[model samples]
Target: MSEFTVSGRYKNRDGYRAFETTIDAVNEDVAREHVLSQLGSRHGVKRTEIELEEVGE
Candidate 1:
């Protein structure tokens, strides 16, 4: 597994909210999916509403 620093934006009551989080995954694609799933479940945001900025170690 690798550690990834993922940054993105999600919809919020105020507007779009920026977020950054560390995730463990095999690659950047998986890291991105993880971020999407997490934010979707926690924040009730759709995949289209989430904008992925960067994914890096």
Candidate 2:
């Protein structure tokens, strides 16, 4: 697995909130999905509401 840095923003009750996190994945696509799923499950943010600004190794 490779480490990737993911940055994004999501829609919330208080408005938009930004986030940056790292994840281990085989590739950038999976890393992006992981971030989306994590934010969705953890903060109740939907896929549509989550905006992924960047994903890089």
Candidate 3:
């Protein structure tokens, strides 16, 4: 499995929420998008932008 790190901000009624998460998946892009989308939807956030980083030695 591939590993990835995601960092982003969510904009909602209250304000911006900073978030980060790491996940293991076969494709990094797909995983990052899925996670970011979930965060926005679950939190009642209307807008979001995410950045993905691959961890290495």
Winner by TM-score: 2
lDDT of 2 by residue, 1-57 (tens): 999999989999999999999999999999999999999999987899999998989
lDDT of 1 by residue, 3-28 (tens): 99999799888999999999999998
- List, residue by residue over 1-57, the lDDT tens digit for candidate 3: 877666666665566667777777677667766776778678755443433334321
- Order the candidates by TM-score, highest first — what do you get? 2, 1, 3
Error of 1 at 45 (Å): 0.5
Q: Rate the local accuracy (lDDT) of all candidates.
A: 0.94, 0.95, 0.62
Highest lDDT: which candidate? 2
Worst 10 residues of 2 by lDDT: 37-46
Clashing pairs in 2: none
Model 2 spans > 4 angstroms off:
none
TM-score of each: 0.94, 0.97, 0.62
How many clashes in each candidate? 0, 0, 0
Error of 1 at 57 (Å): 0.9
lDDT of 1 at 9: 93
